[model samples]
Target: MTNARIAALAALGVGALVLAALGAPPLVVAALVAVAGALEVVGQLGPIALRSTLRTPDAVSRAAAAAAALAALVTTGVTAATVCAGAAAVVALGVVWLEGLVGYAWREATRVVERLPGYTAPHSLGARQQVITAGWYLAVVLATLTADGRSGELVLGLAALVVALGTAAAFVLVTRAAIRAKATVTARIAQALRSYDAPVMVYLSGPEGTEYQLGVWLRTLERLSVRLVVVVRETALARVVAGMTSLPVVSAPAMADLEGLQVETFRVALYVNNGAKNGHNVRYRELTHVQLLHGDSDKPSSYNPVTAMFDKIFVAGQAGIDRYAAHGVEIPADKFVVVGRPQVADIAAAAPGAPLRTVLYAPTWTGFNQDNDFGSLDPTGPAIVRALLARGWTVVFRPHPYSLDDARSLAAIEEIHQLLEADAAASGHEHVFGDRASSTMSIVDCFNLSDALVSDVSSVPADYLYSAKPFVITQVDDGPSDAFLDEFPLARASYVARLKEPGSLEAALDALEHDASSSEREAMRSYYLGDFPRDEYADVFGRAVEALVASRCPAPAAPVPGTPGGAR
Candidate 1:
């Protein structure tokens, strides 16, 4: 075990020894450790479900284990000291849960307010989960603290006990059912995957919500027939990939799915994004690993230190190559294969629609972590939209998908929507291209629909480089002291402005006025997205995968049907 785990165990042992020295029964000590262990398992679960934590079949299995453990802890009766420890631990667990979940609740209640899209998952736990953990913890505490030898107190305690027990039972039953249903889907997906032995496999073993990234990868990997398996983990992430990309998606419930499958069965296992389960899947020694990231950008994640874990890191351009080199990560130059933006080619050009000059205002969501806090939705987003509208240009606001994760981003989106709605009413033209579910559009579709783009530092702008269109980049106002992520490399070539005040607006207007960025676009495009002749990325991507396959397990040279010379 790591030092932290060892430390935690040592601390727990010291605590047990103290209780024993205080004349506590051995049973109490045992119960204390057991309850603490249960809480540890649940607490380590943090906000993200513990089972899905592995991103494997074990996620469901762990869910079942957690629920069962909670039930046993509640139903079992021991000495008052034992009950007190359990209750204190429950209360402590609630506090721990709150420790993780408080931010989620705070964000949900307060709403994340940013001039631009800026966010990360609740630093601790979600509001809903906080409430659940609190309720259970309080119930157990009330039951234990109020317990007495008197019949009246006993009766009241028993009633509290009932509520706690009922709650635990409900969680267990619900978790079991959910696990079973998930297993059914996973088994079906596994069975489907078992039939395919495609040499190139595009595997998505991450959460379901991230399937959008896989959709783009699927489009990038189009033309070549390959298996796009969504390995089942905590979220049925493969469902989205299956729906989006009609490719056969297999759910690997266990290692059994990969049983007997060797390098002969599958040559390359390309992961869309590195996930926790990805580390588990990588253990399969025979499969050649190729890391195909969602999009190529200058974000720290664009060239994570972990990318070195894979055999090959398929990059978008020299930018991706230089990004790792600059970070001083150990991935060699040879493993970095440049594959231009293939997904951009699939995004059909948007037709000019009811507008004088249309601009796609697509800002990225506040990042999930502070390392990539490059969203500008709070401070500059509204002003930028208004400025564009004032200039008689229809603004299409396409906020990042995760923009609605908190209140602040949602409010900003709502404000932008209101601006668009008001503009549409007066101008007789649709200002918001993405609002309702039907009207909700993809980044590529928005790229096609707009004349230009004004986005934050993200893949949206990076991919827009493919259109050779003029776009503006918005810088964040306040962030960490030492996060040096060049999210938008084009800022050096194109318009780069800050969201501190109305600077984003000024820069955007300048871009709209000048709009003539063919030279800049071509140069920056070549810089980020290498020179793809005629803009055909499918051939480039295909050739790269073919090379990977050839390197790992090349096709056997066709034996001259009779003899080498005779066939000729």
Candidate 2:
């Protein structure tokens, strides 16, 4: 519990005890009990509306509620000074503990059901349990209020007892139904898999919020001719992917569970990121493992030594292969395949001399560690956005989703949003921020809407190259030097905004106005995204995947001796 909750509980419990000790009226003690009960309900059920996952009230919270209810019962008995009321209070306490135990069991049962393969526990399960628990607490409050030895108190106490029992019975029924439903779903999924024959499988395994990495490849995978399945190692991700696409999705969180999938016809498995869980699927040698890193960029993730685990690494162009050698991470030449990024096929070429200019300022996120912290949002983001607004350019501010993982990046994002929103209201400029820029519009959409781009040393700039538009790459250090340019070759053809320099941002904006690097950008576009025609890039990737699947298919077993097709 938070400190505030603990304080509240202590105050409620202490106040009830003091009121009883001072011979205060019974109604006053009951009011405190009622407020405590309401607090418990709010604490248990409030967060359910905000979260996407199943959130259950923990044992500590339940114990705290029980303590408050018991304290209220004891105070009522003492205030009345009746042996009959004290005996009734003891009975009420027993019922409350019973209710808590049943609630705890129900929560555990739901968790077990959720872990079963192919079963995603519905949100309704948590909602219903919390409602029933709330009802039980309310019943305890009512019983405590009526526990005095008055003439009609017995009838009221009995009614409250009946309500509490009804809630417990309802909880038991819900738990049983959830478990049965999960078993039925698991059986149906297993039956379907027994007949399914998918030659290509996309195996992704990441934490809850990393679904975006898998999302980037779903459309491309759907365009392939071969039958495919998407297998995930996180149950939450599996549930999300199922909602996002029509393709079959399986959650195999353990090695044994993965083996039980029984995908004998599977020929190839594609992976998106270099998550540690990739090792679990890579051990299956019968399936050819291929790495399709989410995007091609100058970051070290593009050339990690772990890429050697895959049988093949599909990249956008020759620069991807050259990057490995440059970074001194070697894999055999034949393992590399240039499948031009089909996702960028829709990015339109830049339209020069437009009447109104718009710039997309998309900085990357702070990565897993300090070595990967290439984001410029903290120190340079507000300055860059202000420069664009000052130059009368509409701004589309889209930061990386993971950027919010850092407090500083989140604050910077909010600051930029405030600036854009206020400027839009005042100057009549059409600025995009909040969900419109971050969620509703894809990066490709942002690229088409804007005339120029400003971003960090990440995939946004690399992908933005498809437009052949002028872009400014932000450098948080002193300025771009030979080593920086050599490390990030895509920067060679673009304006570099040395954020440390006082006027470097404005200089890059001015350079963008003149289209000074048009020729270099066009050249780098071919070098980075490959020379494939925009219309045919997706087909290139699809055909390459089909060829790999065919090449890796298991050789047909010899016909059984004495069978119809046998030599005998």
Q: Candidate 2: where are CA atoms >4 Å away?
A: 1-63, 78-188, 352-356, 556-568
**What C-alpha lDDT values do all the predictions have?**
0.58, 0.72
Model 1 lDDT on a 0 to 1 scale: 0.58
Supply every candidate's count of residue pairs whose N, Cα or C atoms clash at under 3 angstroms: 21, 0
| Residue 300 accuracy (lDDT) in model 1 | 77
Candidate 1 residue lDDT tens string, 196-308: 54566666666435776676676556567444333443223543454565555444434544442333557788888877777766777677888988878877788789888
Give RMSD (Å) of candidate 1 vs. truth.
12.9
Q: How many angstroms is residue 500 displaced in model 1 relative to the true structure, after the best TM-score fit?
A: 1.0
Which candidate number maximizes TM-score? 2
- Score every model by TM-score: 0.63, 0.79
Worst lDDT window (10 residues) for model 1? 109-118
Estimate candidate 2's RMSD in Å.
Answer: 6.0
